[model samples]
Target chain A: MSMFWIHFKKEMLEAARSYKWIWVPAVFLLLGVMQPVMMYYLPDILMMSGDIPPEAAALITVPPPEEILASTLSQFSTIGLLVLVLSAMNTVAGERSNGTAELVLPRISSVLPMMIAKWAAMMSLLILSFVLGYAGSAYYTSQLIGTLEWGPMLGAGAFYIAWLAWIVTLVLPLGAVLRGPAAAFIALGSAAALTMLASLLPSHLQWSPGRLSAIATECLTGGDPSAWAPAVSAVCFMALSTIAATLLLKRRPLLPQA
Target chain B: MMEPVLRIHNLTKHMGSLTPVKGISFNLERGSCTALLGPNGAGKTTTLRMLAGLLSPSQGEIRYGNSGETGADNQRWQKRIGYLPQYPKFYGWMSGLEYLIFSAKLSGLPGKQAKLRSLEVLEMVGLQEAANRRISGYSGGMKQRLGIAQALVHEPEMILLDEPVSALDPIGRREVMDLLDRLRGEVTILFSTHVLHDAEEVCDRMVLMVDGRIAEQGELSELRAKYRQPLLLLEVEPGEREADWLRSLPERHFIEEAEIRNRAARLVVQDMDEARAALVREMADAGIRFQRIEAGASSLEDMFMKVVGA
Candidate 1:
């Protein structure tokens, strides 16, 4: 729809002007590149620290490129997810609080297109940062450690992105009802709880989207873990959250609280 | 009556326990500029928000044009109306030109037409020179002008502005008021303001609201004549004797209401000529050193004060 594009273009322009495009990907890249380089230089870094003797330092062995990339995915799950959620937390909440929505909402009959455009814009940023960071980590892993298989590496990246996608999408619905930082905090907390639940009873919660992280790591290590259940659920979760955000926004378009 | 451009029947909004807009209704003519005049917390903003479709009414209906159907869920009416809040805020990072284009596009204007209209409205609001400048750097007046421009960019059938000039400096107020004056008859406008002088200056009609209800609404001329009353203003030299004479004048048979402050006394009287003659003769007999005496009709301000105070 043309309306979606118009709003999407505006969102992207806002992202650019706010320097989100620069710092977000840059943070991801730093997080990604740190994983493989740190693993490769563990012995030397330990030696320079003067905390370990030479014989103990010699015992440190470099990890395989697949394992190193999997470690990079873990890093993405922590600091990288936090950065992405922070970037997206203000998408709707900021507009509502700053009084911009009062000017913008009356022009359209429904809030669906605006919600979709915002979600798409956030997704675009998420994919861009994730691709750049994952690629940076892959390139560093192949050079400093061992060559990675293109097939499994791309699959692992896709799975990891899906896992991050659903978590970041939580901010959309949460932001509609709560303030920005509160939304971000709740989204992150939900992700932590879901992942813990999945781990505690892996058989019972096999369909949980939280299992995507582990599935991604398995794919990278040459294990063909089942991805269908979590993938389908992650996509459904995203669609439902977007709809929830649209409905909540439609109910109270002007002020967020009352 | 060419079927009023918009009609509302007992619209109300209940926010939690506070009902800001109690059930009230009014109609707007096709090209008339009507002011929604009220004191603060009189539900002007809540009413405008409901008509603008930002907030759904808890009761009643909004009908647009000749159609009997409610316009609440109609996209056609949504595209035909523009709204500016009491505090109009924009994306500060966006340039004025960009914001206008964005707004016009959202109103369903095509890309080329949106751009052209954006430029036209920018010039109309006297912001063409600042089109490329970011809005955050704009002065308060410039921002208000841009708010008006964005509201006009879509060429909607009507615009609802809440307290449009209430927050401006004197010069800024003058500029916006003049702009509204120029915009009269070109588009229907329903703007809310507590300043009666503003409504009197450019609006042809007024809907004076008090305590979430319309106290009075009619053509400006009709309300002026309806509220018009004989008034006598007498100013005497300051003295205990003159003050006593001024205070005693209020108790006279012809005087209906009186407000005496220091050396001046404003008396509302049944007969202006009789009151003037009696006051002049009394002051002369009492040897009162009166500086000035004037007879006139009361202003709309008195009606406004009376309605709001009640």
Candidate 2:
């Protein structure tokens, strides 16, 4: 446990020094605010472009706060998830390639503590960025569109974070075996494929972690979707990936392979 | 005799099709400094990596300490070791001081002791002024110094350094060599280097490796005395007759081996006095216009070339 803290502190320090702490949250905040603001001005934006008749523009109704917030979760699913994965993609791969692992791995008996610490640090970042982005979206939606209940908003945010967390966690295992950019690309690609599969066969894939996103959106729009199966599966996926990463790293601690 | 601090029994590593370290075994005494000497691709790095516990051996075992502990008890034993890779890399975002402290802490030092040891190693490596600066901006020499500092910060019982000073400038090399000299009695140091001079400067024992095998290993003086032979270096005025005479000298009864260039020949002889007398008399008879002839004992460099070249 003490060893975990030592490695965790190092990971946090690296994140801070690299400005990952700042830029990742900033990108999330930008994505969060853009959703509600853009939806509020869609009618005027169309009229100004002169692409739609005034009658057609008037027919465009601003989405409710719940719907706007749900769309913000979608934005998080795409760009926000990308930013988080990009920030995390190098966590293990960079250390291995740059030869830092050669220096550190021998000091500790097992790689499990270090892997756990890294995962915790990444989780801390993901949680911090998600909370800020989702809060900003809720605040903007309340002021520009309509009022929202804190109960559903917080619950929906939790579900969305779970969805993002599992996908981003894939980078850890992938990064153990591949380069940083390749890990990030495959992580995002897997998330897309899983989501597509879940939608294509919802009855068969109800427990897919990909369903958390849709469940989050449903929770926001006042629909009570069953969140247990997807949330539990997301946690399982994260845990399994973290273990897989640890095992892979232990097998080849200095993986600078091209 | 006390048990060796570390022992290896036929350690081997097969990475894909290339077997870098092929069934090599050696033991390290508790406080002695040994140099792992080898030419490039001699598996020095691979051997050091296995000893450092970074790479698991494909076969055989590495036993540590007086108890002859093996991999099952690695964590406790690993704390007693400090390793520096050939190209030691740190988090570039970290300052030299921070990296040292981190290393010390990871080695199981208490927080306060870790800080004090960090500062001590920083001063020892002469990185006190640049301790706060990011490592990304450090020069190669400074980084090398930091590598040494981190290796010593924990005050481990043994240190495994892979090519510790191979990348340094002359002055940096001198400083590191001096540091290793100072560290000799205090800690068990096993450093690998192809340069025989560096090993000769500080190490008492030498393990010469070639092609993933131990070509020769023993006390430095013992190996020197064993391989030492009477050598004759003859440099003559450039001429076809002189070159022919130099070539012909190797076929003499007293000469064991001959390396001939256009105007120079290095002759290893079976008997120094007989070879010298016969060569001089032959030169006088043939009227060979030789510029210089010197008889001396062969150096370790010659043995290194012989081991590595073969």
Candidate 3:
């Protein structure tokens, strides 16, 4: 168990030293800061136009900066998803390609600990990025539109982001078990295919990890916390996927001689 | 008797239709350095990897003799085994010290202990000066040394090094061999190499593999004694026609090929003493002035070829 923490700490250090933490959140911040500001000013700029037609003027609703900021926060939070995918791309694929996995595996006995440690480290980074993005937009919203209700919803939404981070963590074991980027793509693509399949099913079959994105959106819109059942299902998929990946890895050579 | 540290029974591996290693079995005693010697394409690497637990044999099992009965727990046994592959890469972003520390941590050491062990191992591999440097800046030899350092950091009871010195230059090879020499009393090492001199330098006993089987295996001195062949070559004065006269000697069996090579004559004899006695008398009687007559030392390469038939 201590070994897991040591590996996790080292992984976190590596991520920090590589400045991955800075760049992932910075990209999201750019999106976050822009989303609300864009929403707030675009209507005002259009209203100032002498060419504004009478019929189209009715469609323009100049929301306060807080509403604009909230809408912007939602759009930019999608960037958090991109950060998770980018991080996963490097987590398993880069290590296997560089032969670091071979150097690591023989030292450690079980694939479970190694994969679990790595997953935790990556999830920590993903959650950190999401919180930073939300906080950046929240600060802007406060300065521009004064205080508002539903500040607690931001915390719940951050937890939702964390649960999704755990879902991506499931990719590491599959990456380690299978060789190369093709395996990474196939594993992630399988999850995407599952999501698509669930979308096609009737509402009865819709309660799965596949609906996490929609569940996340609902949580952001001040929906009941109980609506997070689908995201909770995603956690179950994470556990099952991690276990399956470990077993699959045990069957194949984690490190073939160069 | 102290049980063998490692025991293998009928280990086999096949690549498609071709069997690379077929039912080869061997045992190693504690603190013994055994070299797995073979020509390229022989199953030496495959067998070493199986012992390292990096490769699974298609048939048969390898048991690391622990306290429990056979097939009880592999994880406990694996913890005691260390493996250094032929080509190992570190996390490029990591400093050499960080890489070693990470390896130690993976081997179940806690934070403080892992760092301490990593420092000791880096010093052991003569990389302490460069420990803070990124792994990407390290040369091939430095990377090789780091691989050794990482493998030994956990203080494993047994270590498998595949072609450890194969990438080193002559001086680097000597340094690595000297290091291995020092590790004699500390750990049981199973080193695999195609380089004959490396095996000759550090290995007490060796298994020469050929076509997925043990062609020969024993103490170095024993192999030397068993395959001893006494042959003498003498170079005579030019224009003396020593080849014809030497061939006519009663007790000497002449090598016509050596004789034809510029006033040189070769003699093959079972017993060196008897042949020398006969050659000296015949040379004096025939007034043959030869420059050299010396005993030939058989090399491991020669022994390998003779055992494996060319």
Summarize candidate 2's per-residue lDDT along A136-206 as a digit string, tens digits: 98899999988999888888988988998999899899988888999999999999999999999999998
Q: What is the C-alpha lDDT of each candidate?
A: 0.91, 0.90, 0.73
Off by over 4 Å in 3: A45-58, A62-79, A138-163, A177-180, A202-204, A219-229, A255-257, B1-3, B15-18, B66-68, B72-74, B234-269, B273-297, B307-310
Where model 1 places Cα greater than 4 Å from the true spot, the runs are A48-55, A256-258, B71-73
lDDT score, residue B88, model 3? 83
Query: Model 1's CAPRI class?
Result: high
Q: Is the docking of candidate 3 incorrect, acceptable, medium or high quality?
A: medium
* TM-score for chain A as predicted in candidate 3: 0.81
lDDT of 1 by residue, A41-106 (tens): 987778889988778877888978999999999999999999999999999988887889889999
Task: Summarize candidate 2's per-residue lDDT along B1-310 as a digit string, tens digits.
Answer: 3448888889999999999888998899988999999999899999998888888899988888866465566667788898989998889999999999999988899999999999999999999999999999999999999999988888898999999999999999999999999998778999999999999999999999999999999999998899899999999998889988877776788888988888999999999999899889989999999999999999889899888898
List TM-score per model, in order. 0.96, 0.97, 0.85
Cα displacement (angstroms), candidate 2, residue A133, comes to 1.4
- lDDT rank, highest first? 1, 2, 3
Residue-level lDDT tens digits of model 3 in A1-258: 877787788788888888988898787777767665665567677878858986686587656544554465456434555556666666765666667666777766677876677777877777777677667776666665555446544644555574456557666666766554555466557666766776788376556665555555555555654545666666777777667766666555444444
Q: Is 2 or 3 the stronger prediction by DockQ?
A: 2
B1-310 in candidate 3: lDDT tens per residue?
Answer: 2457888878999867989998888888888899999888789878877777666789987878744546546666777778898888888788999988888877777779989999998999899999999988999999999999988988898899989999999888888999999998678989999877889898888988888988888888888788666767777776555767755543445331233355665554577777778778978988887888776744667778756665
Better of 1 and 2 by TM-score: 2
